[model samples]
Target: MSSSSVRGVSATPVESIIEPLRECMVSMGSGHGKETGDRRSPERTVLGRVASIMEVFNGGQQVLSLGDLSDRTGLPKSTLHRLADQLCQVGWLERDPGGYRVGMRLFELGSLAVEGHRLQETAFPYLQALAAKTGMSAQLGILDRTEVVYLERIVVGPVRLPTRRGGRQPAYCTALGKAMAAFDGEAMRAVVSSPMPRRTANTITESFALWTELDQIRKVGIALDRSEAYEELVCVAAPIRDSGRAIGAVSVTGPAGRMRWRMATEAVHSTAAAIWNASFRFGSAGARM
Candidate 1:
C-alpha cells in the first residue's frame, strides 16, 4: 500500500484507511450498503422514533410482536430489536411470551396525570348502582378533544359491549359525548369543525343535525344514542354539571330496542346528578397527608 502526502503532511497507508471510511459511509448511508434517497432527514430523530414506537401500542392494542412493531412503525427489524431492548431496560416497554407490551412503569407515569381527577373513585359507586337499577352497562366519561374517554364502566346484563375503561369513542355520535358537548360550547364547536365520520347508518354526520341533537339534550337534560356509534347498542346519558358546564357524563347502555327509554333516561339523569354531588363532596373532603 502506498502512502500519500497532502499539504506537505504525510497521510496513512491508503489501503488501511479506505476500508474504515467505506464502512462508515455504509453505516451512515443505509446500513445496507445502499444510497439513502429520502431516509435521511433531520425530523427523523431518535426521540421521534421512540415516540413512534410508543404510539404504535395505542388504540386497545395490548401486545405486539416484533414483526407487528416493524410493520406499524415502519422501522427495520434490527432497529426495532435494538430500540425495543433499550425501551425494555428503561421500563417503557416489556417483553412477554406473547410479545411486547407497554410496561407497568409507563402505566405508573400515566397514572400521575389521571390522579389529579379522582372522578373514577367518586363515580364508581354511582355507576354500579345505575347498572344494578337499569340492568344495563353504566359508564362515566369526560370529553377529551373531540372524543369521549370512559373513566369507569359497570356491566350488569349479558349483552356484550365494546366499551372499556380508558377506551375512547367519537364525541359526535355517542351519548356521553352529546351529553357533555351539550354544555361545553368550545367542545361543540370543535366537534362541528372536525370531521364527523359515520360509524353506522344512524350516525348523525350532518353538522345541523348534530347541533339540533345537542340542543335537544340541553332542553331535556339527557342525550340518546340509538345505534349511532354501534349497530346493536343504545345509550342514554346525562352530564355532570359544574358552573354551567359539563365536567363529565354518566350513561346507561344496552342492546338496541331492549332499553326502556324513559326509565333509562330517568336513571341516567339521577345518576349524573348523584355523581356530580358525590364528586364535589369527595373533592372538598380531600385532606393533606
Candidate 2:
C-alpha cells in the first residue's frame, strides 16, 4: 500500500478524509475552528467596516470619493465599494455629485440616539428656561471623543453663535467643553495637554494656562468662554453631574457685550442647579462616574 493508504487504511476513498482535514486545517490556521466554536461570526467584520466608513464623517466631512473613503477608512477599494453600496442601499450613506456622504438615515438615527440620552431629556426643560430667561441660545452638550457634540439646543428667537443643534466644537475652547472636561480628571488633562488650536485671537493657545483655568472651573463648577471660539460671542457653562460625576454641560451663549462676567456666572449657577436637580429626578439617577 502507498504511505497515505497505510497511515489511515482508508482504501474506500482518500479524497473524503483528506479534503475534510485540509478544510479543517485551513479554517484553524485562519483563526476559525471548533475550538473557538461558532461564536465568532462575520457580523463583527461587517459592523467594523460600517463603523470605519461612518468614522470618515465624524469631523463633518460631507463628501468623499471611493479613493477618499478608502484613504479615510483604511479599507481596500474593492472592500470599500462593496461596503459603500450596502450603506447607500440602507440609507446610511448617499452618493451625489460630490461623492459619498452620510445620508438622512444616519441623521435620523443620530437624532434618535440623542433623544435617548438621559442627559438630553432631563436637561431640555432647564435649557428652555435658561433660553427664555437669558434670551440667548441654550445648549446641552457632551464630550464625544475630543469634541463636544451639542445634543440639544433651545434658541431664543433668532440668535445665532456659529453653532447648530447638532454641531460640534473643540473641547478646549468652548464653555460647555471646559465644563465637562474640568470634572473628567485624566481626560481633562489629556485634552488641555494636547495642542490647543487657535480659533480666534481670544482663543486660549497655552496648554499650561488652560490647565490652570480648568482647575478653577472644577472648583467653581462653571466655565466661561469669552469669545474663545468665535469673536464677539460669549458662553457661560456649568457642569451637569449624574450621581457625583459630571456627564454633560449646559450653556447660555450670546453676544459677549450682553453677557457680562458676573451676570453670566450667576446664570450658569442657577441653570446648572436646576438641570442637575432635573437629572437626578428624571434622568440617569444612579449613573456616577
Candidate 3:
C-alpha cells in the first residue's frame, strides 16, 4: 500500500489485479467448457433409456422383473432400478410381485389419443352392430409398421380370444391387416419386406402366396383369415375406403368351427361401407387415422 499510495497515484493499478484475476478465472473454467461440450454428445440420453425400457412392454408382456428388463434392455440393473422407480412415480409403469408392468397412465393416454381423433368413437357403433349381428367379436384396425394395431374390439359372447385393443398382430396373418394392406401400396410393400413368422399351419409364410391373396382381396374388397393368426380363430375383414384408398379395416372374428364365412363376410363388408360413409360426417381428415 505504502509503495502504491505515493503522491496519490497508485503504483499498482486496480486494472492490473483485475486482468490477471479474469485470466485466471477463464483458465479455471476451460475444463468446465470441455465438460459442457462433452455433454452435447452423450452416449445415451435419459429419454432414450426410458424409451428402451418402455419398448420391452410393447410385445404385450404383462410384467417383467428387473432381471428380465436387464436382459431385454442390456442396461445395468442399478440404472434400470433407478429409471423404473422414476417411471413408476410418473405412472408410466407399475410395480408388481414379479416386477413391473405398463401402468394405467399409458392406457389413459392411449385412449385420449384414439378418442381425440374420433375414429374410435365413430367406429364403435358399427363394430358393436357387427358383433351383435354376427355373434362374434368385431374389430377395427389400422396398419402400423407391417403390424395391425387393434383400435377397437366389440366382443359379443364369451370368446376367449388372445387379442386386445391396442394389441398388435402381424399384417401378413390377420384379416384386418390383410384387408388394409391390400389397398395401401406402402403397407403391402412393408409386409412383403418384413419377416412373416408362421403362427399356425395356415399362416402365409411365402411372399408370392401372400401377394396372390392380397390381389384377390383387392378384387373382392374382402380378406379372410382362416386360422392363420390363431388356430382357434377365423375372421373375415373388409377395408374402409375413401375414394379407393383404405384408411382402416373392420373384421368379424369367431371360433373356427362357429364362424359362418358367408354371413361374416357380408356383414363386415357392409359395416366397413357404413363406417366409411359415416366418417365423412365426422370430418374425413380424422378418418385418415
Candidate 4:
C-alpha cells in the first residue's frame, strides 16, 4: 500500500501513526489505561471535590476546620471556602464556631430514601406480627456500610434492648447484620475487611470464622447472635430481600434464656419470606446491594 494511503498524510509507519493518536487521546482527557491506583477520573466537575470534602468528617471527626478539610480533601483553600459556603447556605453542611459539621438537613433528606422509608412501611406489619406472636422485640434493620441501622421495631417483651429506631450496631456481632451480609457480597467483603470488635465473648472476631458463619447463614436463610452484641441478649434474624437481593433483615431479640434457636429461627425465617414476597419493589436499593 502507498505510504500516503496507509498513513493518511505522511510516510510514517502505521505503528508511529497510532502512537501519536494514543498520545492525543491521553492529552484530551481520555483514559490512560494506567495502573489502578494511578487511573483517577479526570476532575471535570465540582461534585467529586465536594464529596471528598464531606468524606473527611467521619464518626470520630464530626467537625473539621477549613484547614483540616483542605488537608484531607487536597483541595485548594479558596475552592474549599467557596464550596463550604455553598454547602452551608444549602443546609447540606453546618458551620460551627470553629469548624463545619454535617447538618441535620442532610440526614433528614437521607432518611427519605425509598429503600429505607418505603421498606420500613412495608415491613412494619410483619415486624409487629412477629413481635406479637413470639412476645419478643422484633426489628427491621438495614445495613449501612459495616453497621446495621434499625429502621422499624415492635416492642413486646419486658427486656430492654439497647437498639432503638435509628440506632446502629456492628454488623459482625448483630444477627440482623449477619443476615443481610450473608446475601450481599459487598456487605460480606466489608465485614471481612474491617476489624471485628468483640461486643461480647460470643462475637465472631476472626474473619475466617465469620466467613464460615456467613456461608451457613446463606444456606439456612437465618442467623443467630448468641449474646454477641450485648451480654445475655440473644437474637435470631433472617434476611429480607426484594427480587432475590437482600435489602434488609428482620430479627427477634430477647434474653438468652428465652431465645431458643429452633423456635426463633422458625418465626424469623417465615416472617422474612413473607416480607420479601409482599414488599419487593423495582426501585429499592436492597434489591441489588
Candidate 5:
C-alpha cells in the first residue's frame, strides 16, 4: 500500500496482501499452464495401481490373499491393503475364507461390458432362438488371452457341463474355443506355441496334432468337442464372422450320449449364420457412430 501510494497508484488493504499470495498459490497449483491454477496430479499412478490389481484376476484366478495379491500384482502390501480396503468398501472386493476375490461390483461391471459389445447384444435373440429350436444349450465365446470366455449362454435345460456365465475354458479343448482358435491364424499359432493344459482325458494335448485338427476345422468351418473339456459332455461349434474375420463362435453343448452328430452340426451351422448376420447389422449401424 505505502509503495503504491508513493508511486501515485491506488491500493486496498485486503488486495495488497492477498493478491500476491493468491498468485503464488495459483502458480504452485498450475501444472501445464492450461488453467489459472494447476497442480501436478498423481491420478495416473493411482489408476495404474488399480488396474494392476484388477488384472490379476482376469485369467480366472478368482481369489488371493493380501500377500499373494501383492506378489502377483507387484504392488506394495501396505498400499494394496489400503486400496483393498477401499475397494472392499465399494463392493469391488470381497473377503472370504479363501481370500479376496472379485465381488458383485465386478459382476455389475462385466454385465455393462457385455452390454456394450454390439455383437453380444445383437446375437442374444438368435442364440435364444437356437436354444429353443434345438432344445439344447447355446453359447457364444470369444478368445481372451489364451482362453475362451463365455460371453453369452442360453440353456434350455439343466446340463452337467462346467460351462457357466463368465466361465473360462482352455482354448484347445472346448468346441467354441477351438472354433475361434482355428480361424484366428497367427493368434491361434501363438496359443499353440504356449503350453497347452489338459482338462480331461479326451482333450488334445499334443501341439502338432492340435495343429492338424485346426486345419481340419478351418476347412470345414466347424469344430467338435467330444468330452474334450469335460468327460461325458460333447459340443459342436461354428464360427461367427464379421467382415470376413471370425470374431467369435457359437456352440450347442450336451451330454455325449445324447448329442446326435447330425442334429448338433445343423444347430451349430444355423446359429453361426444367425450370429454372423446380426454382427453384420451391428457393424453397419456402428459405422454411423
Candidate 6:
C-alpha cells in the first residue's frame, strides 16, 4: 500500500508539494526567487533529488523503505539513508516499522495556503446547498497548472468517483478546470500551450477544439464535462470569481444515466454565483467581482 493509504492521509496536489520546496530552494540557492527563472546549481540538483524521493510517496504507494526509495529514486542505499535520515530529523519524512512515510510537517505547512483555505471556507455552504438541491456530488476546485486540485467535495448519495479532496484531475478534461480556465487568460494559455493527455475516449485533447470550447464557456459562464474526465460521469461547472478574477470553480457531478444535466447546470451556476457574491461580501480587502 502507498504510505498515504496506510496512514489514511488525504491527497495533496503536486503544486502544493512543490511550493514549499521552491521557497526553500530559492532562499538557499538564489538571492532572488524569480518564479519563472530556472536554477540548475549543485544545490538545485540536491533539491531535485529530494523532490524525486518525495514525489514517489503518492496515493498509489505511500510508505517506502530505504531499499524501496532507492529503487524508486535510483539513488544508492548509502545516499538514500543519509538523505532520508536528514529528512526524518527535519520532520519532512517519518520512519515507521514498515518504512518511511510523508510527515505531518507537510500537512502543517499545507494548512498555511491562504487561497485554498479561503476558497474552502467561502464555498462550503454553497457546496452543501448544491448537493442538497441536486442530490449528486458538488465539488470546489482550483486550477493548479494543467490540473484542477479538488479542495472540497459534497456527496449526497452513495456515488463512487476517482477524485477525492486534494486529488487532481486534468484541467483540459474536467468541467471544474474548464470553467476556471475560461475566465483566466493565463490559465487558458498554460492549458493549451501543451498537448492535453487523453484520459477517456471522449476527452478533448485537441488544443484548437479545447480553445473553441473554452470560448463558449466564457460566453455562457458554465462548462460541461460530458464524461470527459471520467467515463460515464458527467459534470457541470461554473467559475467562482474573486474580485473579477477566476480563483476557483464549483461543480456538480453525477453518472450520465441519472443526472438531469440542464437542471444541474442551473444549480451549479446559481451556487457558484452565491459563493462569488459571498466571497466579495465576506473576504478580506473588501473586493467584489
Report the candidate with higher TM-score, 4 versus 5. 4
The C-alpha local distance difference test score for the whole of candidate 3 amounts to 0.76
Q: What is the lDDT of residue 172 in candidate 5?
A: 84
RMSD of 2: 20.0
Report the lDDT tens digits of candidate 4 across residue range 98-146.
Answer: 7898765554334333356667877888888899888789999987768
Rank candidates, lDDT, best first: 3, 6, 1, 4, 2, 5
Looking at model 6, report the run of 10 residues with the lowest lDDT sum.
Answer: 1-10
Candidate 6 residue 70 Cα shift, in angstroms, is 30
* lDDT values for all models: 0.74, 0.70, 0.76, 0.74, 0.69, 0.75
TM-score of 2: 0.60
- Local accuracy of candidate 2 as per-residue lDDT tens digits, 1-289: 0011111112222222233333443444444333356544322355545665676675546788999988877778999989889989988788988788876665544433433255676777778878777778888887654578888888776556577766888899999999988887766877877778799899999988899989998788889898999988888999876445465678888887777667667876787777777656654422344
Higher-ranked by lDDT: 2 or 5: 2
Clashing pairs in 4: 247-286
Residue 28 C-alpha lDDT in model 2: 43
Model 3 residue runs over 4 Å out of place are 1-45, 48-116, 284-289
What stretches of model 6 exceed 4 Å from their correct place?
Answer: 1-112, 284-289
Cα-based TM-score, every candidate? 0.61, 0.60, 0.61, 0.63, 0.60, 0.62
Model 1 scores worst on lDDT over the 10 consecutive residues at 1-10
Worst ten-residue run, lDDT, model 3?
Answer: 1-10
Kindly provide the TM-score of model 6 when superposed on the true structure, using C-alpha atoms: 0.62
Model number with the top TM-score: 4
Query: Candidate 5 on 1-289: residue-level lDDT in tens?
Result: 0011111113322223233333444454444333334434322255446656666665556688898887887778989999988879987788878779876655544432333255577778888988887778889887664678787899877775577877887788888878877776765787678787787888788999989999998888889998888888889999885444466788988877778788779888887887776655545112110
lDDT of 3 by residue, 247-270 (tens): 678999989888999999899999
| Candidate 2: segments with Cα more than 4 A from true spot | 1-116
